[model samples]
Target chain A: MDVSEQIHAELKKCGVRLAASLPDDWVAPLIRRLDADNDIRHVPVGRESEAVMVASGAFFGGVRSVAVIGNTGLLTCTGELATLNLRHQIPVFCIVSMRGSIDDHQIYQEVQGRRTIPVLQAYDFPYRVIDRPEEIGCIPDAYQWCRLQKRPFILFLTRALLKGRRWS
Target chain B: MIAKEAIRVLAAHRGDAIAVCALGVAANEWWDATKAEDCFQMHGAMGFAASFALGLALSLPNVNIWIINSDGSLCMNPGCLLTEAAQAPRNLKHFVIDNQVYQTVGAVPMVNAGRTDYAGLARAAGIASTHTIDNVPEMEKQLPRLIAGPGPTFVVLRVEPDPSHINTPPVTYEGPEMKYRFGRALEKRFGISVFNSSGY
Candidate 1:
């Protein structure tokens, strides 16, 4: 199976009934996979913060959820994540693209590569990067861990995991 | 109309609807009016309560959801309207308390000074049923229909700034306690489990 399919299966195993996303190139396939699923409710939001807030809301309704977005988008929503999820102690699982990695030659993503982990660390938000398809299975455990942590947790998909394909 | 009075009116007709309130005045007023555990009154995240409510509405599908968003909060993220519009959950109702100022912080004037047409913005964002009410009587008159109608509805309640309630305290519970209270309330109300066996 493809990495996207593997990731989708893991999300299902994690009991994610809802997914809110604003896609970047790397996470787009997974977003499409979630969008096509009938059982999992997929919400396409205007901004990354909306996805984070939406997932936070789903927790109150007894639904497990995930927010999917790009690394840059992840930076945009940190304040919301800190204030809403951290302050309220609501756990939201986010799947993000690990932009600006060594393989990522995009100039726009360079700042994110160096700064993202430090930002998450400063906020005490937990995160793990999945660079290979085999690590996708860890999502269920991460999801549960986020729930236990009662805060925002991020599962980042690295360039290596989503590479080997050409979009243009 | 006063915010408390408007909230009281909304609470009276609330029925089974679950509410998510934005931080500050909207949340504080709702807590004061209803003292409801089912409602999640946000202490932070000033702008995204609308998105939060939409998520809950989409997830539950059977439960009614209301968002009490204030003008200052709405201005912080007006793009939420487009997201709400796109989902168009029939169970969600959006309300904005337009006091023309940040009520919690000593009545500082809002970014656009309350001249921004929020209902018009909602309508423009594709929410077909949008209403703006400026009085308690009008809210009372229209709330029954608003509650009964299929939603993704938007309502703007325009009220005068009340300096007296500016420093009103927030709800009793906050942080994790507030989280469990709201979640457990929903679980009890709907017979669903928000926490796992070990009690998250």
Candidate 2:
């Protein structure tokens, strides 16, 4: 099976009934897989913040959901994550692309690589970087931990994890 | 029409439907009118109430979901209409309370103020059923049908901006309390657990 398929199976184990996504290249395959699944209701949002909000709402509805977006998109939605998830203590798990990493040669993504973790730390949002296929099995535990934490938790997919090789 | 009165009228007709209210006037008014635990009032993320409601609607499928949005909030994230339209949850109804100004911040004029056509925007976003109601009577008259109709339907409620409303304040409970109340309320209503045994 493909890496996206493996991740999809893990998400299924999480019992994620809904997924709201705004795609970034690294996570696009996973988003497409989620969209194709009949069991997981896929919502394609215009903005990354909408995915965060949608996932938060799903939490209240007793639905497990994940937001699939890029690192840049994650940066754009910190304010929403803070005020909505942090203030209200709402748990939302997000699967974000780990862009701007050493292996990611895209110039536009460098800033995101440099800034994403610090920003998450500054906001006290927990995150886990999964750089290998073996790490994908931890998704269900991460999902449960996100619910336990009662705030936004980021599960980052590195280029190596997605493509099975370094871009560099 | 008075915004409060309009909200009151809308409140009277809301049966078992869940509400996701945007920040400022509409959310405050919703709390003032209903004191509903099942309703989730936003404190931040000004524009994403519609998105949140759409998620809820998709998840519940059997329950009606209403978003009490605002003109300012709508402008903050107009693209929500596109997302909502694409999903087209039949259980979702979107209501934009257009007061023509930022009423919570002492009634500052809205950008493009009276010229922006919100309902038209929703229609262009692929929502076939849309209405702009300028009075309480029209709101009362149209709500039943709109609620009954398939969504994502959009309705714009136009009202004069009242600076006095700024002083009215939001609901008494703060953020975390609001979460527990809302989550617990939903759990009781739907017989589904929103939290774990340890209550995270």
CAPRI grade, predicted model 1: high
DockQ of 2: 0.86
Off by over 4 Å in 2: none
i-RMSD per candidate, Å:
0.8, 0.8
Q: For candidate 2, lDDT tens digit of each residue in A29-91?
A: 999999999999999998999999999888888999999999999999999999889989999
How many Å off is the CA of B175 in candidate 2?
0.6
- On a 0 to 1 DockQ scale, where is model 1? 0.82
**Cα lDDT tens digits for candidate 1, A1-168:** 999999999999988899999999989999999999999999999889999999988988889999999999999999999988999889999999999887799999999999999999999999999977778889989998999999999999988788753332
* lDDT value, residue B180 of candidate 1: 90
Please report how far candidate 1 places residue A24 from its true position, in Å: 0.5
- Note each model's CA RMSD in angstroms: 2.0, 1.2
Question: DockQ for each candidate?
Answer: 0.82, 0.86
Error of 2 at A19 (Å): 0.7
